[model samples]
Target chain A: MRICFYPGCSYASTAGYKESTEAVCQKLGIELVVIPDWNCCGATVMFGENKLRATALAARHFALTQAMGFEEIVTGCNACYATLGKAARLLNEDAELFIKTKDVLQALGLTLDRIPKIRHLFEILTKAMPDAPSERYRSLSVGAYYGCQLTRPHQFLDKGGYPEILETFLERIGFAVTDHSARTQCCGASHAVIYKDECRNLSARIIREISDKGAQIITTICPLCQFNLDQAQTGDLTPRIPVTYFTQLAGLALGLSATSLGMNKLLVSAEKVISRP
Target chain B: MNKASKPNPFTSISDIATINACIQCGTCSGSCPLSDQMDHAPRELFALIREGEYDMALKSNTPWFCVSCYACMVRCPKEIPVTDLMYAFKEIITRKRTAPKNQKMPDMYRAFSRIIKAKGRITESYVMALYGVKHPLDALKNIPLAVKMILRKRLEPKALSVSDPESFARLFELTEKSEDKA
Candidate 1:
């Protein structure tokens, strides 16, 4: 099956997300056609700054993906997936906003005919990955942190307060998904660099929240979330739970080797998770 | 530390409504992720808003880094809409140079604005490549990591694949028209 893909910015810079995601897809035999000239999903700042401009910016990509003959657009970045998803819903809900955005697009000689379905990579894997195991590991409890981007803004997908997409994917791979409050909490996101101490404190809250709930491993789809949570700990009081890309875990469960899964590049060191019997 | 007493910041508005709704129970500050890092509590943000101290309210860093997490709104006993107030403050603060001194973030915003002004959309590859160009050494550091993900299909190069370039360009023209009209 083929789906239009938007990789966003962080996928190119993150540790092993790119490699492991490709390997897993190849193993699963799904062809991911990257959308030609794909652009940013307008993350949070865009909407915060200019709703009209941000909606128009995000809607353009959706329109392009639909034009490319794909009903669904799979996004690699959580923020992008969420932003596009939110924008699509907003445009659909607010006619005036839609017209304004449409007008903005029309001058460019394009129109947002429809909003394509936006799916996170994890959502795709859960639906697309065949049940037959490519590999197996001892049963482990994993924490699925969906972050604020996916679940919030409430206008898109499953549920607003609690989402089951990530958990469902983990379960499909034969691992147990843990229930935790931190699943939707802010990990201090883009502020990681500007407000390191604040970010670390907030990230620590999430790590402790997940760990307290008994999740042995933490898996996510956002690179910034992964980086902040993975690097928060200094000496003592560190959870030391390995933070991994959902793709890497899928690769491992799909029979790909550890190196092929990009295990070496993880900042938090997934050796703890990978070394498990 | 000046913990003895505090005024409400939200009271100055024509509506003293949401101000009285606050219980002064510190629940808003308790739920805020950045509260611990701030010099004044979010509850204090409300306090300042009530006292007509708009300058003090707008000058604080407490409003800039909010993460927009609606925990306070969710748990607020009075349904005070603390997050919305914070958004208003953010808009006010954001316009007045109250943003965190993000050396790269401003560049990021400038780049984003340029993309919207140029093509009406942000090209992921273009943004990354440009970001890399601006920070060559740092971008270079990401190369080895990028190369690894690219081979795995997790990371894609900007030149690899794109949507219809013609249609994409037309979209940019539309944004310029809107700007002219605006």
Candidate 2:
């Protein structure tokens, strides 16, 4: 019930991912020890700039996690999870890159003696929370959005194309899960910021698909996915499904108040849905 | 390490070998969600590379259009690591400064990299501001959303730096030195 948390760069700024995660973890009796002085995971931008630097950026976190005496590093963002995971895989497979990264870390008075396992916050929560169902959220139907980068290119958790882990978790926790084809679809990732019109269409497609499947609300595991989906709904997107983090729903199931879970941070507003029955 | 023995950090032979194995079966193109936006689909990019048309491959908007969803990478019939190959293409484009004149993605990447290089962390507002300097109209369009985010306390204009600034600075310097040697 303890984890070494890496909140990533956007954790604090992304729509209650931080607040809900903290509240949910605290209630679940999970101790979150944040890595001290952790840097950015460089997301998808760094590897395109320089492979060695990108690997070192993520490796720095690995060393920090080891310093904290933890074998795994848990992060909430899909980009961070994939970035760190990709770095770890590269270090393990490529000796030259590993040595180069070690040299970089050594210069900073740190050592990459062990590569820590990169875990998604969702994985940790599912493992820690008991499967005891509660009737509090049984009436609320959710469209589980996994975003890209969680399971794809690394099928450790579930099938990449159509993942059901989120649904299984939701059903186990008492919320009704909706079946949708947009589960592993891309939310335009970071490109949504630069290419607004195009990325809006991309995010809108996912939202439309999930809404058409009769989902009352959409739940996202990644902050960027939630942000893109929520913001895209602003301009003429129909149904206006509230995009809430998985943590927010889990917090509600744990008997936390809506305001305490940061549900108010959502743009489309989950008020009506959660306030029902 | 000797020059011949040392792998090219930018684009390794193994990476090319992986792309070389691509059968041009179009599974990658079909699987890609943003293929419609790219000038050349993932399958076509691989074909271009195999034909020694490196310039065309680098110049294509295909790589920049990649959202790194890895749908192509996972579903490729030949397992060509399509996503990573896209990253490799971006690196080559960046190093060569050959990004198309109309492409804003390279500039966006530059802005993002600059922030992380300075503060050891990214401030979303700062990134948007920096990127905005180059594209005022795009930034202008986001004002409404930005205001809403600010009101919700989700976007902060102030930047956040790592707790240990000195070591963070040193890490970059040493990494750059190592890259220079490579």
Candidate 3:
């Protein structure tokens, strides 16, 4: 099936997300058509900087998808997904805000009919493969970290606390999903890049919780979570547990090569975890 | 007429009225991950809003440290959209230019906005450089991590510009004009 894809700026640079997502989608026969000349969703900051600009920025993408005659636009990044979703919610509910956004779009020779359905790649991938996977994880313990944006403010795919979509998806794919308390908690989000010390302290709490749950490796859907958790490793010389993208795990089950999926680019080496393949 | 024409920072925010709907339940504060670090937790923050302490609410480090997790909103009994409220506070702080003293967030947001404004995309490498230019000491401390990322070939140092820059530029210009009108 063909669908409009918003790669969300971070997709290309964040090692395995794009690569593994492509490999898995190709295998599953999901054709990802990139939206032409898409701009950044401005993540969480833009709305804070200027609400008008942030709404228009997100609505611009909605207009592009609607202009293409498609109703659903799939996003890869958690922040992008949340931003687009929030903009859609606001534009529909607030008439004044909607008119203002529409005015801005009209100024640019565009019109936002409405914010189209914004979905994360994980939801799409999970629905795409309802059948049982032929492969199994044997005994690898994986902690599925959803982070903040993906399942927040508006439990888009699942509940805010203890969301089971990713966990169930992991189990269905035959991996042993570790139960952890930090499933929907914040991974310091993008603030880690700014307030390094403070964000790190918060991130430390997450890593500690996930590790204490006996997870050998942590699997996350957001790039920032993967970066923060991986970099949030303690200074002491204890072995670093691998923090990997869910796409990489799915790609592995689909029998894709690790190198092709950009597995080597992960900070905490995946050698010990995926070396089995 | 001049006072009427003045850009009231409060009205620019889409849903400032929601602050009144906040029930003052401590759920927002209880749910916040960084409550201890915040000067006024979400509960107290909303109380400040009702009390008309906009300056205090904006000055507090709470919004800066929010992480935009939305946990509070999800768990709030009033469904107050606590996180979005925090985002509104963020906008107020940024627009009013009162981002507390020595906040890395306001500057980072500015640099981040500057980069996105120019290129229409987020290139982490360039953002890092731009941030380093602003905070040289912090930049120096992160060099080792930078080198590590570079060695991993994750640094696509070349910035990616949007296909048509004129339209994107016009969008910003129109947005600013709307702000002026507001």
Candidate 4:
């Protein structure tokens, strides 16, 4: 029940992902040891900027994880998960790049002999939390949003296009899972910032689809997805549906108070939904 | 070597021979979430690559429009690694400074990269400010949301840096040196 955690750049800043994740992990007796002095995973931008640098950036975390006496690196952000996973896969397959990355790490007084396994926070929660202890949240319906990077290009967890793992987890945790097609839809990713109007349309489309499917609330695994979906609902003509992190819901299922789970950080208020009798 | 004689950048990151195996199927294009916004769809870019139209392929906003969703990469009947190809395109374009003038994604990415390169971490507000310098109106539009986030304590005003700054800086330098040799 112990794992090395990589919170990524946005984890601490995003809506209650860090808070609720820490709270739930503490409750579940899962020790999350954060990688000390960890750098950014380079996300998607670094690879496009320079492949070697991106690989080295992510590989740095792998070496740190190994130093921490862990074989796996668990991250809450999809970008970090994918970026680190890509670096690991590349290092494993491309010996030349691996040597170059190792040399780079060596210069910084670090070693990269072995790559660490990358995992999402969702994967850990699904395995750690048992079926809901109480049926308090059974009436609350959740639209599970997987974002884009979690399963696609890597189907280790579930089918890329239409993943049901999140739905299965939600159902097991006693929340009603709504079947929806926007599970793996892109929330415009980082580009949502530069192309606001266009990305808003994309996020809005996902929100509209989930809402139309009769989902009272939407749950997201990635911070950016939750941010894009929540912010897109602002000034939106449709009824506001709260977009929350999966950790927040898991916390609630464990009978933790909403405030303690950082539920108040949501842009569209979940007060009404969580407060329901 | 002249521009035409220069090796295709795609070959450096991935096997062009595999990408050449692209059957011109539009599965990649059809699977792309932002194909409508792209100047050329993923399949068309591959066709352009096959035709020795590297200039056109590099100049297209198709790569920038990619959100790295990898839908096309996973679903490509040919297993062409379409998403990785987009990254290769982005790297080449970024290196050569040849991104299309209409695309701001390159600048946005540069802003993001600069923050990480400096602090080894990202401050969301700082990144937005740096990226927003070019698009003041866009930044203006986000102020309300930013205010709400700040109120919720979700957006940190201060930038966070790694504890070991010396090693973090050295990593970048060493990586750049290694990349130069490569």
Native contacts recovered, in order, as a fraction for each? 0.24, 0.75, 0.75, 0.81
Model 1, B90: alpha-carbon shift in Å?
4.1
After superposing candidate 4 on the true structure, give the runs of residues whose Cα lies further than 4 Å from its correct spot. B1-9, B177-182
Q: Please, what are the lDDT tens digits per residue for candidate 2 over residues B103-157?
A: 9888888899888888999998888889999988878888999899988988876
lDDT of 4 by residue, A36-144 (tens): 9988899888888888898889998888887888999999988888888988998999998889888888888888889888898889999999897679889888999
Best by TM-score: 4
TM per candidate comes to 0.74, 0.95, 0.93, 0.96
Q: Each prediction's Cα RMSD?
A: 6.5, 3.5, 3.2, 1.9
Q: lDDT of candidate 3 vs native?
A: 0.80
Q: Show model 3 residue runs off by greater than 4 Å.
A: A130-132, A237-239, B1-14, B21-23, B180-182
lDDT of 1 by residue, A158-226 (tens): 564677878877787767778988787888876664455446677888888888888888998787787
Candidate 3 local lDDT, B7-95, one digit each (tens): 43566555567777777779888877778778899889778766666667768888887878888888888677778867777877766
Look at candidate 1 and tell me the lDDT of residue A79: 76
What local lDDT does model 3 show for residue A197? 72
Clash count, predicted structure 3: 0
How should the candidates be ordered by TM-score, best one leading?
4, 2, 3, 1
- Model 2 chain B: ten consecutive residues of lowest lDDT: B1-10
Expressed as tens digits, the lDDT of each residue in A14-72 for candidate 2 is 77888899998998899899999889999999888788898999999988888789999
For model 4, how does the per-residue alpha-carbon lDDT over B1-182 read when each residue is reduced to its tens digit?
56567667666555457777888879989988788898889888888887778888878999999999999989988788888878877887877778999788887888888888789998878888998898787778779888898899887868989986766877777766433311
Error of 4 at B122 (Å): 0.8
Question: Against the true structure, whose DockQ is highest?
Answer: 4
